[model samples]
Target: MKEGIFFGEGMKFVKDDYPDIYDAVVGLNKAAYTGKVLDYKTQKLIAIGIVAATGDETATEKQMRSGMNELKITKEEIVDALRVVLLTSGMPAFTKAMKVVSKL
Candidate 1:
């Protein structure tokens, strides 16, 4: 509850209007917490990479910035991940993703 944030309104919408998706998100949280393949920071970085590779701009931008802030992931690391994505997902797919990363 800060003076001008919309967190409460957004949470209310998720709880009231998107209850089913909200419930699934809770379940997904449990599954995610159970997994331990990578460290939390690494996992977040991988998630950023996947989002970028899939061309999800909103998610990519969010994760890219969050990773840099919370996980201390450097821009160079993100750039390397994008390079791998380029090889696997094709340059055409990665082209837009790289653009998004570069803006970061």
Candidate 2:
């Protein structure tokens, strides 16, 4: 991953200390994000919702930022995705994610 790309956990330490594990994870991410079916933007939208459902503020912001920066996705599109979190994950998670999204 690029130095500032907000990829999983940086993975630098893992690469240094545990090359095998790090390689496996990198392969897994590559396979998962192949984007042969759903395009990457849709995948990103789903990712945002999943992370938002967990109510992880930092992650939510990072996802939104990455989506915006990398895919040029709009806040409205992200809000649409968050609505799913609202239904499936409930008010607290939805509200928390919405708050973060709102700032962006």
Candidate 3:
């Protein structure tokens, strides 16, 4: 397996066993990250919020750490983003996100 940024276990498995699909998915990820308006950090933060709102604890934690370590995103900044989740996604989602943030 190749070493790269943020390839989940499933992606790793796909890359190893199904190179064609992995290439397509990797291409899609690259395209998604190349948006003209939002910067990479903002996109990552949004991804974190989406994952958090879904109550996917593992994905939330992984994305949180990736944003912090790779993008140098501050905890305060993440909390600020979570505020949007609170308003739109409601208390449960926001609270779950908060708990994930607290761990980091």
Best-performing candidate as measured by TM-score: 3
C-alpha RMSD for every candidate: 5.3, 2.3, 2.5
Per-residue lDDT tens digits for candidate 3, residues 23-79, read 887777888887589988999889988888888778888989989988899999999
Residues 1-104, candidate 2, lDDT per residue (tens digit)? 22234366757788889989887877777777878999888998999999999999998998999999899999999999999999999999999998998899
Query: For model 1, what is the error of residue 68's alpha carbon versus the real structure, in angstroms, after optimal superposition?
Result: 1.5
**TM-score quality measure for candidate 3:** 0.90
TM-score of every model?
0.71, 0.89, 0.90
| Top candidate, metric lDDT | 2
Please provide the root mean square deviation of candidate 1 (C-alpha atoms, Å): 5.3
- Cα lDDT listed for each candidate: 0.70, 0.87, 0.84
Report residue 19 deviation for candidate 1 (angstroms): 5.2
